[model samples]
Target: MGNCGSSASSEIHDIDYGHERVVYYEEADEVQKVGSVYSQPGSKGLNQDAGILYQGYGEENGAFCGVFDGHGKNGHIVSKLVRNRLPSLLLNQRNTLAKAITGERADGDLFQSKQVIKWKEACTSSFKLVDKEIKLLDNLDCSCSGTTAVAVVKQGDGLLIANLGDSRAVLGATTEDGIMAVQLTTDFKPELPCKLLLLYIQFLFVA
Candidate 1:
């Protein structure tokens, strides 16, 4: 990995992923201005937003990280959900992705194809469970709490991200558009038509 100082935050951080460097413009608001990814404090949904990033290179295990954005309250729920579970889950499932991609699945094998599908399914199911658990929380300090979540688990040249809400995943691509970047996740606007599908895709795409 590598690091650099920015024209933005005073905090010095070196971001080196051992791959071709990807540039990000990084959008920040007065509040999201904390200059951190997914640091948006949860205001509506579970009072918290959490995310995880796992970089699985060729190593037996991958580099893993998760962030929780707390809303309507402190970062408690987001913190617990990520610190207590997200990391372990990412680690446990990453190898399956690796095997699926690098092993027999490269051929026309439908059986091994299940690995990728399983990964997607697992991530989707996990998000639902997370949402349910957050809703079940009865904290007096956070009765109306809700949280947005994003998680990543990487395997080989493939990366998987799961998300809910506006927290986003953008890809840095070298294109004719001059260091172009695109949002991989759809914004889940609650006021839109088919809000639920958007939300599902939001969670699925880790937006």
Candidate 2:
């Protein structure tokens, strides 16, 4: 008799993973700036990654701009919201600030759709707009399902960065000093050694 402890063997099977079939549509406009989006493997939605670039001008200001990156499950949604809403919010904020100063809500009236306004004023307005929008998001419970948001504003040759999570933005400049790379955003997760190994296993046996 054969060993009682021995187990019977069946046939072996092979499988093929065709992940290359996935195609994501990315939108970009270059006349003013650049924009791109891509989803990682773990992304459960259309895109787990999102980014944006905005340009603004005023009377005493020129070209004030920003880049925002949103990362997480809802990264794509938040990113889309900010890209569409942030610039408009900034425009309104600028109007509010100008009014705050001169006591006239529409003093400079940059949104008249006429002449270009100053860059500094435009940029300043943008900053206030983004902050207000973020606060609006805070009123609701945005933590359990949250995303990383990093922003950058151009200030002359210098850039200002506001960060909440990981997606990074690096400033590259070449001058008399040479090539220098300045990192703008920092990751929100503190545990560097341990990575979040999220596994989505699907076992299907068609008979």
Candidate 3:
């Protein structure tokens, strides 16, 4: 639902939803040049989808993109909350992790691996924190309302992706024939063998 960039010339639009700050690009051309987004309301008469495209996120050239799909009565609120907050939350988590691993290291595959590990940890921790924040919202009824999130962070030539629920991320690669779409994250459905096993284990413990 929003996009942010580092360009001084880019038009800046700010909208405040309560105390939450939502920043976005006002130039439609600029957003279209980078990527396109589409969301339609479901039969329930409300669109529970939200997305964010952030440029110049962590570093000058870094970017962050995310899509969230909400379900249940308060799905719209949940999706928008995640959309507005997740990018900053993830960045904060990454900075915290980065501070813990300070010092120079040999620049090579090891450096890249370390970067990935830091990002992976940051993403996991941020997601958990977001979930907790949602649960703690006094005005929000989230007992049965939740959103699925799929996000990607681009830094230099590397990409770190995170997914929850059934939302998906895909890569478009130009091949000899044409552009090929490659699926990135696996859908986390309850019917998955791993999920079923975990559920069964929990059920056994309860029984």
CA RMSD of each candidate after superposition: 10.5, 19.0, 8.7
lDDT tens per residue, model 3, 1-207: 333333332554444432223344323233323543444444655667777667667853667878888889998799888988899999999888877556635666666566667888888888889989999999999999999888888777677777888888888888899998977777778878675212110000000
Model 2, range 50-147, lDDT digits (tens) per residue? 44433333232222233334455555455556655655565565555545345333645543221123323554456455545654775443343445
- Which candidate has the top score in TM-score? 3
Give the higher-TM-score candidate: 1 or 2: 1
How much lDDT does each candidate structure score? 0.46, 0.40, 0.69
Query: For model 1, how does the per-residue alpha-carbon lDDT over 153-173 read when each residue is reduced to its tens digit?
Result: 544334566666555666666
Off by over 4 Å in 1: 1-52, 56-67, 74-76, 90-112, 132-142, 176-178, 196-207
lDDT of 1 at 171: 66
Q: Give the winner by lDDT.
A: 3
Please list all clashing residue pairs in model 2, or write none if there are none. 58-117, 58-118, 59-117, 59-118, 60-118, 61-118, 61-119, 61-120, 62-119
C-alpha TM-scores of all predictions? 0.55, 0.45, 0.77
